[model samples]
Target: MPSEQDLRTKIESGLPDLHNLIVTDISNGCGQSFDVVVISNTFEGKNKLQRSRQINNLLKQEIAQIHAFSCKCYTEAEWSKVVV
Candidate 1:
């Protein structure tokens, strides 16, 4: 079973240079579901599907075992506006 810390590490490693990322285990400690938020300059030109694909590809193995996965992706500028 993957722990929250394990998931966080994998995501950070996969998406190097990510800024202000958040990964939450929404499954009440079961590690079966996740809600992820990531902000990166790399996402500047990507559409939602493309961004999702990028993350899903990186975490493919880990995702295979999970019941659900949700992601909210943003570019640095977008993140700044939304967070403030």
Candidate 2:
């Protein structure tokens, strides 16, 4: 029963300096699956696996209950490039 808002709050608390976050429940509001994107300095030097691990660790308990999850993290600079 991990709501998107709950996950968002936890991520914000964990990455206090996160620049941006987007969480979507891909399970059609069932809360079983989620897609998350986080832009933060925390991922500045990390590779994909490291960034994923950081987010996975941050939401470990919630992840255990969810059916599927995906996290994409980027630094502010990287984010700008991706979106632009």
C-alpha lDDT score of every prediction, in listed order: 0.86, 0.94
Best by TM-score: 2
User: What residue pairs clash in candidate 2, if any at all?
Assistant: none
Quick one: RMSD of model 2? 0.7
Q: Which ten residues in a row have the lowest lDDT in candidate 1?
A: 1-10
How high is each candidate's TM-score? 0.92, 0.96
Candidate 1 C-alpha lDDT tens digits along 1-84: 676787788878888668878889989999999998988888888999999999888788889989999988999999889979
User: lDDT per residue, candidate 2, 1-84, as tens digits?
Assistant: 999999999999999679999999999999999999999987877899999999999999999999999999999999999998
Enumerate clash totals for all models, in the order shown. 0, 0
The lDDT, on a scale of 0 to 1, for candidate 2 is 0.94
Candidate 1 RMSD to the real structure: 1.1
